[model samples]
Target: MRKYLIFIFIVLAVAGCKKKNKAVTSTIPGKPALTTPAQNSVCISGTIISATESQVLFTWNPAVNTDSYDLVLKNLLTYTSTTINTIDTKINATLLRNTPYEWYISAKQNSSSTTTQSDGWKFYNSGAGIVSYPPFPADIMYPAFGQVITPSNGKIELYWAGNSVGNNIASYTVCLGTTSNPPAIKNGLTESQLKDVAVTANTTYYWRIITFDADGNYTDSGLFQFKIQ
Candidate 1:
């Protein structure tokens, strides 16, 4: 009888151990969700901004949950990308002068997640704008040459010589005015074609051509001043 009692007690203890282990194994917690990073976000908008030979200065709106931003530089042709720098706020990177550089920003929410990429922007050391301005509509050519020919209709027939390099001429922005302050802007044009544009007789118009390369850096032409007769 004593042996049987002892055996029964051991069986009960083993069953209790099994029950405790099962409870602990079934109560495991779920993993936490990953933090979301803001996508492809970058801004250079600010007041009193300028770029020197070696650096650029600009400000942007802060992002939510972002600990910092990653600045990336990419070669337009080869599709090679490199992380040039990381910063908690705006940046002024020392860059090669007069070279075309493509850059963009990505937000780092934390160690876990990052935002989607913001749109890329381009700028030259020569103080050119990032966005491309296509050829002027109603103009004689997409990229108007320095000298123009006046047709019999008393209209100015302008012609644009495309870029000498392999970079395609995306478009041009034709400004018809004396100065840039209040110049009339015409957008979109076919490449390398002559366009007949009407103008007032004996009036001078200042115009320029803005061309976008493959990666979208705009190389602009100096202002071409002409007169209508």
Candidate 2:
């Protein structure tokens, strides 16, 4: 009878341990749900100033067992990103005028190495008012920044995305040369792409685009460089 009682006690202890481990495993956090700015939202109004303005506020539903959150904002056109860590469910960020951005949130637990990412959403900042908003600079598309063309292609194609927000884009001017700040190779171009650009072998070429709006407002895309074989 004494041996039987000891065996029963050992079985109960092992069962209790297994039940506790299962409960802990079930408490692992899940992905957070993103809210606000709705997906593919456009023309969000905000102030454009030298000082940072709380242009847009991002929010998400808290994840279970999460201790903190990381919010990431990315400029779709410029390929720049910003991340903010917080314990709160919401955050405000400053964004550029007349630009598109994508954002998401990650829920994290303090004790675990796992992170849950919320669904991403995109929005466009319209900037202050209709009159205050200017057309954004062109975004380069082809031959990505700092790419090298080998085997002497002898020709390159330049492509970019032109912005037309409150105003219509009138024309584009392209500058391409060996210098960092190259002179205009073509001005008053009506197209978004320039093809068959002659290039010299074993030379780095710098290029940029200047976009003009019908309202006489203009914006410049910073310089980008590429090398030929």
Top candidate, metric lDDT: 2
Candidate 2 local lDDT, 1-229, one digit each (tens): 9999999999999999999998878445678888777665554544445543436778888889899999998886676899999999988777776666778988888888888888877666764444643456677887678998763257778899876555478999999999988999899899999888998898988998998988887877778898888
lDDT of each: 0.49, 0.79
Checking candidate 2 for backbone clashes, the offending pairs are: 46-128
* RMSD of every prediction: 18.9, 6.7
What residue runs in model 1 are displaced by over 4 Å at the alpha carbon?
1-96, 100-151, 164-166, 180-185
In model 1, the worst 10-residue window by lDDT is 32-41
Model 2 TM-score, 2 decimals: 0.60
Each candidate structure's TM-score, on Cα atoms with residue i matched to residue i, is 0.35, 0.60
- By TM-score, the best candidate is 2
lDDT of 1 by residue, 30-108 (tens): 2222121111222222222345344544234555555666767653333457774454456656544334445666666
- Predicted structure 1, TM vs. truth: 0.35
